[model samples]
Target: MYKLNVLDKLSFIFIIIGAINWGLIGLFNLNIVGLVFSEPVNLIGRIVYILIGISGIDMVLFLFKMRKSFKE
Candidate 1:
């Protein structure tokens, strides 16, 4: 079995949060992050979004690595 390191675990958590936020947005037209950082130009919200995006990319890479591990 493949064990996740610290960065992998953090990336997974962020990705899950991003997915939930998207679900809420689609279902109820709500944005949890925006509500939490309620500013017209919130730097922190932007940073959160950027981190989520990076986490998504990290997950894709992680998935590929896992796939390769399974095939070997």
Candidate 2:
């Protein structure tokens, strides 16, 4: 089994949120983050999008580390 630290867990959660938001956009054309923070093009909403993107990057980097662990 793989162990995830706090940062990993948080990033995974954010990624999940982003996935769900995308699903909503595909199915209903809704934007959850924009709904929560106001306009999708606004600064706070952009920040949220950036954070989610960073979380995805973090997960990709973590996967490389995890692959090494799996081989050991």
Candidate 3:
């Protein structure tokens, strides 16, 4: 298992935020990111979406695989 540390904490926080954003979209049919990012038709918003999606993919992968960087 991975040792808990600052980076771990920050990643978990981002995962939480990503989860909440998806929940809002599914339940309320709302897009907090779209509203916040505004002009999704442009470049910056696309980059933001890509980053969020990547983070989500990583979190999902981590859930099934216990991190093994922790040493004896």
TM-score per prediction, in order, is: 0.91, 0.89, 0.60
| Winner on lDDT (1 vs 3) | 1
Candidate 2: segments with Cα more than 4 A from true spot: none
lDDT of 3 at 55: 65
Runs in model 1 with CA error above 4 Å? none
By TM-score: ranked, best first? 1, 2, 3
lDDT of each: 0.91, 0.91, 0.68
Cα lDDT tens digits, model 3, 1-72, are 565566456567767776887899999988777777784535766766676677677666665555434332
Question: Tens digits of per-residue lDDT for model 1 on 1-72?
Answer: 578999899899999989999999999999999999885529999999999999999999999989999998
State the displacement of the C-alpha of residue 11, model 2, in Å, after optimal TM-score superposition.
0.5
Residue 38 shift from truth in candidate 1, angstroms: 1.0
**Over all chains combined, what TM-score does candidate 3 have?**
0.60
Question: RMSD in angstroms, all models?
Answer: 1.1, 1.4, 3.4
Q: For residue 33, what is the lDDT in candidate 2?
A: 92
lDDT at 25, model 3: 90
Tens digits of lDDT, candidate 2, 26-46: 999999998999864689889
